[model samples]
Target: MAKLIVSKFGGTSMGDAECMLRSSEVAFGRGASLVVVSATSGTTNDLIALGKASESQPWAEAEKILSKIHSRHVKIAADLHLPTESMQRLETLFEEMGSIAKGINLLKDCSVKAMDTLMSLGERMSSVLCTEAMAQVLKRHNSDKKAMWFDVREVLRTDDSFGKARPLTKEVESLSQKKLGFLRDYKTVVVTQGYIGSTEEGMTTTLGRGGSDYSAAILAEGVAADVLEIWTDVAGIATTDPRICPAAKPIDEISFKEASELATFGAKVLHPATLLPAIRKNIPVFVGSSFDADAKGTWIRKEVEDHPLIRAMAMRKKQILVTLSTPEMLHAHGFLFQIFKIFNDHKVSIDAITTSEISVSVTLDDSTLVNKKLIADLSEIADVQVEENLTLISLIGNNINHTPGLAKQIFETISDINVRMICLGASKHNFCFLVSEDQSTQAIQRLHKKFVEA
Candidate 1:
């Protein structure tokens, strides 16, 4: 029996009619029973812009955005020559989206919940187009299989977290077995939307930005799939971002731990949370290009043949370092707890942290700096000094902490660069530090040349 495969195509792979058709061919060739798709390229951003304009801008401006979105999808539908029923389905979705935007405009409020509903339209629309494309492919090949669209929100249950909803794994697993287990029949190719789920109360919620990959992994785990394939524009996972280092090579295989670290530190190909479900179920993931399906892609699994000390490095920019100093923290038990509690209450996740006798410094996404209340709360407990325009450079590999002279070699490679807030010993797979944003590229180049290229 063939393995049960769940394949997900990224936005670029679903950018246009031709792209969707190509991705459908790849999915069919790979024997993927379940196909997941993101919105066409730039559609999500346009949706976001439409929501903002509806809330604050004139109705004319918001309608213009809505028209742009409609035109783009209409062209795709026209190119595909979808039947009247399919076109009417898309028309209904468009009308629903326009109604939501008009409601937001009248209320002059775009709540996170409302924004999730708006953003979800992107995936919902693309899934319809992709299902039509898959049907055409099946017909072209004269296959007996049928193509159908599955509403993921029915099974992908999540909390009402709005913009960044969390999936209830057990509930998703139970629902998947009940609703999606039939996919094993290999008779119907089910195309579903990624990145959006529904709360128990039936309100729509999104799994955050770049969450379609996570959505694929969740569904893969839900059905106990043998493989999860992520089809994007890029050929495969490289030693580094190829745009940054032309000499970077594609990694044929990587372990789950290394891939997780690489993603958390800022690899754009995979979302940070994408691997959690796959890892839990020990499902192997394939990252390949939908445009060039024949290329040898990267495979992420539990173990690989080689475990390099420094496999790959990733850099995340726009980081803010917050240093909290209070003499009360010196040998104080609850003081540290209080500081963490405040951050937890604010829902700001810390990336890297270091503590001294009286001071604790943590790295956060620069976006969190907008929360004045979080900063004010921390200021009440300690003298808070926030440093902006920092970058986090992470080295992902195996035995990074156990290996001797690794840090020395790393520092020696970039001896001239100023390194701040070193985080190590916590994970054997990651060694991360902070540097000025302006110097990050130079740091990564020098480090990559020394570690990866060498």
Candidate 2:
């Protein structure tokens, strides 16, 4: 068995022709490797827009957008020195994508089915192009130019859940081994698509937000890869979002548990759910800067020690805080239960929540589908208000069961800020607070200063 590494190249790595070439160089530079690639920068978003626009109004504009997309990819292929045959093939794929977009426009309502089919074009095109480019580079180096680009739609099986498809884990796990075994038949590299999988019925599906990272993790876990490198635009995982805290430094390593906490809260580096499959397989994931691949990156392991009480931070902005107040909830069995049932039925997840003697407040993503039926039921005895224009900032660390008056210190640090509400997690390692959107950056900087920096 050959040692394998699955490098999950982010959008920045495959952003354009130059980025794609540089990534090809890094592949051989970093040693024996397989690669998973996301779409070129902004491709997925463009596809999503095309879908929405087509749904509302399928117009001639779809053709204009399609032409624009085709020109970009064709230009990139030309710049990359891809063989004429490969360039033509890449163009054909884009044409197919364009066709789908136009179909959505004509349909005047892009179904989840159509959206999944459309969104996948981003990764599919990138991998195909990157594979061709890598093949040319390897040929120049006297290395084998026989890399096979596997379409994930053929193997990555999942449910028919439309946009957010859940994989048939056991099925995929078995298939992964089989596929890798077949892929290893060639001594060259294997380039695969990220962020897109297929349903049992052979329809395209996505793993929700950050699906590309999740795709990488699943592939790594499936192959038992020695390393799963997540190459992005940044150096690595930072102590805090530098955009919010300029002093934030890159972390060299993090435990899976810690990484999970940070990702879930707001690290914004890895998809929060991306770590689960990796953790289950005890796979080590590396987060590194694509622009500077030589730098020491962050490593995530299954079990770890020596984490800071305030290791890293994150935030979910533009959240809605819902407060339900009623005397009926106090000492009334199943009152709060019914409220949650409503939320559960609607599929809106609660991030942080607090309960009082007569009221229950929860922070959610403000999905439009929150059921009116549940609201009507709650209205029978409770008052409800949806508070928008708020942000929830959280600090995730390890063994924070007690933080030496951390609550008091946090309040004192950002006391002048507009503090709307706060909730410390039961584990005590994480403390979350609500504040005005305008003060979010300042509040984060303040907490970063007094607590983290000297």
Candidate 3:
């Protein structure tokens, strides 16, 4: 309703009690921060792991599993001396999570729909903790503390699609305006979570991986927030994976389009879908470090200076390449229709696709959950091969297009490494290639040294 500042902190940003304190400090450092947080360290995985393990057995076993996870947060609150009301809400959340786990166990099958409902607790629990922590720390340090635990589940609505649900925009906007309807009524801080949402029927849902960042963006857009600060573990988006490209430098600023490209390519710092809402609203999103609040980090915006090509590099290791070779693809019109229809029926998303004479090669994220039954259908028209454990390296930048020797420079650097496949003219500004998972890190290092570093 008002120009609020919505900040989203990742798991690493709120990894512990200390990180939570630092997140609040970062919030206060910038006035009127609306903080959104992921689960406290390892909470999501713990919850999911329990959900999977509990499906085969009695509900009580699953109930105990979740009780352990709940106690960890309880201990942190006890250590911090959280106020009465917040702590009581947390107790209520644990009860809900426990009940949900039992339900999953009774169901015996953890469908994506079921999993989404079970896993919403990650954000729900963390929001309660973060809100309480913010209240205590801000009251103590900033001396002008005003914070509330905001329920995004009440506002960030989505379909009942479970693991990878699309946001229900109209409902979410209306609910957000109503729930956060008050920021215009007053100046305050609100803490919430990323990733999870609820349906109109009150069913719990998750907005895919990195959904929390998207949540932050949507809230910023809804409240007409001045800025969205995304707190993470790294030094903003990098030129390359620092693990591979040691010379990779932090980007001071990048465009939303560029940020989306980076997320698609390999920059795990921001979710691929997070930028659209911010871009639509023309709100600036800042990615900063949770450890050092003063770091300039990176700002994703609408404009950029005369920056160099290849702003960053992103690599993903878990992949499978399905190369379709058939004569029908050579001169066929909309032959792609047949190829896509098979994937669509199976609900598989092709991460990267390239076509040529008599062949179409697709790189799919491993989590698309493909199986041999679907492959049998594809083998009808084309020869199918599944290249497992490959890594995708995407060179990302605005001016990445129409570079004459850029491809040459890249290949020359990795001339010796066995490159599996390469795709250029990748959209407006990316050139991606698939390499052996083993060589991914080395290939990135070599590319950075040759093209990026002095």
Candidate 1's C-alpha runs over 4 A off are none
lDDT of 1 by residue, 1-454 (tens): 8889999999999999999999999999999999999999999999999999999999999999999999999999999998888898899999989999999999999999999999999999999998999999999999999999999999999999899999999999999999998988989999999999999999999999999999999999999999999999999899889999998889999999999999999999899999999999999999999999999999999989999998999999999999999989877789888989999999989999999999999999999989999999999999999999999999999999999999999999899999988999999999999999999999999999999888
Listing every candidate in turn, what is its Cα RMSD in Å to the true structure after a full C-alpha superposition?
0.8, 2.2, 2.2
lDDT of 2 by residue, 204-311 (tens): 899886888998888877776777888898888988898878898778878888788788777788898889988888878888887898888888887666677787
**lDDT for every model?**
0.95, 0.80, 0.80
The list of candidate 2 runs beyond 4 A from truth reads 183-186, 367-381
TM-score attained by model 1: 0.99
**1-454 per-residue lDDT for model 3 (tens digits):** 5356788899877766677778887887776557888887788888888788778877666767777787888877777677788788888888877776777777788778778876778778778877767877777875654888777888888887888888877777788888887766545678887888888888888888678898888777776777888888886877877776667798898887878888876678888888888888889888888787777799988987746677777898898888899887877788789989998998887888888889899998876534777789889978987788899988877666687778788898899888788887756578889999988888888777766785
lDDT of 3: 0.80
Among these predictions, the greatest TM-score belongs to 1
In model 3, which residue pairs have backbone atoms overlapping below 3 Å? 194-212, 195-212, 266-314
Give me the overall lDDT of model 2: 0.80
Which wins on TM-score, candidate 1 or candidate 2?
Answer: 1
Q: Write down the worst ten-residue block by lDDT for model 2.
A: 366-375
